[model samples]
Target: MTAHLPVLQVVIPLMAAAVCAALRPARVAWAFAVLVSWTVFVIAVLLLREVLAGGTISYEIGGWAAPWGIEYRIDVVNAFVLLIVSTVGAVVLPYAGDSVEREIRRDQIPLFYTAFLLCLTGLLGITITGDVFNVFVFLEISSLSTYTLVAMGRERGALTAAFRYLVMGSVGATFIVIGIGLLYSVTGTLNMVDLGLRLSELTATRTVPVAFAFLTVGISLKLALFPLHLWLPNAYAYAPSAATAFIAATATKVAVYMLLRFFFTVFGATFSFDTMQLGFVLLPLALVAIFSMSLVAIFQVNVKRMLAYSSLAQIGYITLGISIGTVTGLTAGILHLFNHAMMKAALFMALGCVIYRVGSIRIEAFHGLGKRMPLTMAAFVVAGLSLVGVPLTVGFISKWYLILAVLEQGWWPVAALVLFTSLMALVYIWRVVEAAYFHPSPTDEVAAAVREAPLSLLIPTWILVVVNVYFGVDATLTVEVAGRAAEALLGVPR
Candidate 1:
């Protein structure tokens, strides 16, 4: 049982998701999802501990030998990713009951939970598996389920958002499959570890470069890396609040993990950065995304769409860290990955609470909300502060490290630009803050009817809120894990 924990981490959720569809009441299905998600989070915690105390844990499916049979590998880097995904699932599912009930039809709710579970399973599978093709397989599983979840939104536009995402996602999947097939044609094995070993000797091969190019574009599409991020804002704005919270916090982060895995673990940094000078390519894109997306966010009237755009800009921060391509830089990239998850999950759920009462997430709906829904608005403000890199918040910690990384590289202008963009974040956040606190409600009925969200929603949301502040002040855990994760990917000795 202990030896098989790696496989159990993924299998339990997959099996539970299948059963969730048949559950009688939607609440029961949600409860089942909550249970399985928390259990997986516990498993992730344990896996991270084991990897830290010992070393990488590898499990061959059905006890077959590696390089010939399927393998699930766990190491510092992916263990950290697994922990982030499962923890977000656990936090988001408990909040789903109220949010989903408000946003989805009663009849469709059970299937919604099933789809959430499937998405969770796919994300976990993508993080834990060692095969390149397995990554694509799980990527499709998560992508297909995500489309279903998005389409379940109450708004008619949800269907359109789902359709657009489906088209873009299919294109991404095709490119990834072609890339994987090309790699196999050259190296004759599908295991990522085996491919990495074989491809080192073939670094200059034309086939390797083409495969790398395809994989970069495919994975970039999945990560919503700038210009490719058109599908994200709508999927987030119109989807059921629970789906937005989960997808916003986890999906792109996992795609970024796929990029890290391929660039560092599979291709080797030398070929990726030194020979190809991928930094020159990625750095400009990251800078443009950071500025352009944030600029777009400030003009949005819908708060959810504003944050959706904000998410794209935040992704640029993560990519910029990666483009720097140093130990401190990678550590900062990975750190922001986890920190942004905490911030967005908290902020979106706060918005969900607002939606629960006001039935909308538009700027107009937020009028006088600070007086009506004190706790939810407060949570939003704190998380919003963190998003703007204010002191003693998770956002600041990420920025602090990110700035240090930039300065370490002697790119003073880049560091200044990072600060400038954060102030832009403040402007957008302040728009909602001012509307909620200073403006009067248009109708007396809204003020009378709106109240704090139910305790079920508030409690789970504040758990993340507490984590944001706690991790910010005492960042021992995230820093330690992110450092080791970076070391592992960079092949540095612990």
Candidate 2:
């Protein structure tokens, strides 16, 4: 059973998704999803522990051997990622009950959880699989489920947003599958490890470089990297609050993991950074995303869209760290990956609370909310401060490492820009804060009627809020794990 933990991580949620779809009562399905998510998270924790103590764990399907039989591989890098995905899924599932009940049609609630579980299964599958082709399969599964989830938004525009995402997502999938096909054509192996080993012998081939380009762009689309991130704001803004929180936290992070796996592990860091000079492309994009998106976020009236744009900027921080192309840089990227998950999830969930009580997320909707929904608004403020990278918050931890990483590279100019964007984050966050705390609550009935969000919603929001601070103040554990994961990816000795 212990040996099968890698497979079980993906399997349990997948099987339960079918059962969830068949369940008659939406509340029952929610309860079942909560159970399945917690179980998957426990499996993820056990897998991470096993990898930390014993190193990488690999399991073959039906007793078949690797390169022939499909394999699920868990190492420090992906093990940590699996933990991120499952942890967010577990935390967000419990929150989904109240948020979903309010946002989605009552009859559609069961299907929402069903899609959520399938999305979870796909994300875990993408992270755990060792076969390159299997990544594409799981990517599609998650993508399809995500489109359905996005369309479940209460607004009519959700259908348009979902359709746009579907078209863009399909194009990204096509590029990824084409890249996978190109690699298979040259290497005659779909297993990632075998492909890596074989590709080392064929570096002079034109096919590999083309495949790399295809995969990079494809993944950039999926991860919502700057210029390619146009679909994300609308999708996130219009999606059901539960769906927005879950997908915003986990989906892009998983896509970043895929980019790392392909670039560092499959192609090798030297080939990716030295031969191709991938950092040249990534650095410029990262900088633009940070500065441009941060500016865009400050102007947003719709709070959800504001945070969605902020997510693009946060992705910039992650990619910026990766662009430095050093062990410290990679660690910073991985740390931000984890840290941003907590920050953004908590922020979105707070907005979920706002939307639940007020039925609106416009900045004006938050006027005097600090007094009306004190706990929920307070949670938002703390999480907002984290997003601004204040001292003693997870966001600050991520930036501290990023600053160190850039300084280590003697890229002082880049380091300064990072600081500048931190201010940008502050401005955008302050917009909401000022509205909530400083302005007067509208005299309208809805504004007057708004009260503190229910405990059911507040509990989940605060759980992530506490996590944002807990991990920030005592980051020794996350730093150690992220450092180890980065070293492992770069083949640096412990």
Off by over 4 Å in 2: none
Name the TM-score of candidate 1.
Answer: 0.99
Model 1, global lDDT: 0.93
Tens-digit lDDT track for model 1 on 285-312? 9999999999999999999999999999
List runs of model 1 lying over 4 Å from the truth: none
Give lDDT: candidate 1, residue 319. Answer: 98
C-alpha positional error of residue 465 in candidate 2 after TM-score superposition, expressed in Å: 0.6
Q: Model 2, range 172-248, lDDT digits (tens) per residue?
A: 99999999999999999998889888888885889999999999999999999989998999999999998999999
